[model samples]
Target: MRKLIIGITGASGACYGIRALQMLREIEDVQTHLVISPSGMRTALEEGTGLSGEDIRALADVCHHHKDIGASIASGSFRADGMLVAPCSIKTLSGIAHCYADDLMTRAADVCLKERRRVVLMVRETPLHAGHITLMDQATRSGAIIMPPVPGFYTQPKTIEDLVTQTVGRALDLFDIDHPSVRRWKKECATEA
Candidate 1:
């Protein structure tokens, strides 16, 4: 079984993380360990997902509290395949970039980076200033993939859910987890006029 750790932060797009869990559930071989920052839960509520913290926790195979620094996922020896921080807030990104590991979410990401595992951070901030760019650069230098939730127009997305699914699907692609929902780019064949 492939074990993946997932973190949800207080960023605006809570749906990305929730959709990730929902999609991962369809893949039987993938076991998910979820950690939600306190702000993440509040944001989820505010974003109107209608899912309480318990409801969200129920989606994961294992749920770790953000404050639980002792969680299995916080250790490099735990052997998780990798981690994904969907809707990764700037605060969380800063923590991961600096190796601050103050909470389980950042700690697990730190462990993943130290272990040379794939750590995809779906940073959700727009109108980013230079400092945010610098933090992203720092995190990349430390071996984290900074993937902003930018939707692909080529997919011809018609709904917000479509855009979210595409982004989440691409993020999962980094872990080599295939989901039927992701639409791949194809070269168009030119016909003779």
Candidate 2:
């Protein structure tokens, strides 16, 4: 079974994280370990997911508190395949970039990096300054894939949910997990005229 650590930060796009969880639940082989920052919870409420903290937690196989620094996932020995910080806040990115490991989310990311495991950060901010770029560079240098949740228009999404599914599906693809919602690109071929 592949174990995946999912982190939901306080960034604006909480839907990415939520959709990731919902989609992962469909795959029988993947076990999801979820950790949502306090600000993450607040943002989910502010963004009107219409689901309480309990409702969100119910989506995961296991849920860890953000303050639990000593959780199983915080250690490098834990055999998690990788981690995805959907809608990663700049603060979380800085922590991961600097190896601060102050909380479970960043600490787990640090552990994954130290173990040379795949780490993807979906940074959500826009109009970024040099500092954000620097942080992204540092995280990338440390073996984390910085993936911002930019929608692909080729899918011709008709709803906000469709866009969210496509972005989340791409993130899962990095982990080698195939999500049925992902609309893969297929080139059109023309016959000889």
Candidate 3:
């Protein structure tokens, strides 16, 4: 099975993390291991994901406690194909860049880097300062892919949902998922038959 580790931090846009989990669950070939920050749980509930271990379980194959550094996903020997930190907060980004594995999410990211596997940071922040930009740079220099949740409008998306799907689709593309997660505007099709 193709395994991926996903981390959700207590960032403002919980929808991104929830949507990513939902989409990952739809991939039969992908087995997901999840870790959620304590704040993430609150955000998930407040943002209407219903917030419980069961909710996390329904989204991913396995859910590890935030403090469980001893989890299988924390070891390079487990050999995951990649790690995704969806809706990653700036704090989480800083922690991961500095190798501060105080939480399972950061530790899992650290493990992926050490194992030379893909690490995608769906960093959810805007109007970033130089320090924030530097953290992203350090992570990329360490072989991690820095992906912010910035969406595009060339497609003239009819709804906000469409916008969200586009970002998720692009993220999935980085992992090279065989499935198309969202629709793209084909020039010919946009012009009609």
Q: TM per model? A: 0.97, 0.98, 0.90
* Residue 23 C-alpha lDDT in model 1: 97
For all candidates, the clash counts are 0, 0, 0
lDDT tens digits, residue span 26-107, model 2: 9999999999999999999899999899999999999999999989999989999999999899999999999999999999
Best by lDDT: 2
Candidate 1 ranges with C-alpha deviation above 4 Å: 191-193
Query: Where in model 2 is the C-alpha error above 4 Å?
Result: 190-193
Kindly indicate the candidate among 1 and 3 with the higher TM-score: 1
Q: TM-score of model 2 relative to the true fold?
A: 0.98
Query: Once model 1 is optimally superposed onto the true structure by TM-score, how far is the C-alpha of residue 74 displaced, in angstroms?
Result: 1.0
RMSD of 1: 1.1
- Writing each residue's lDDT as its tens digit, candidate 1 over 88-137 gives 99999999999999889999999999999999999998899999999999
Q: Candidate 3 — what's its lDDT?
A: 0.84
Model 2 residue 67 CA deviation in Å: 0.9
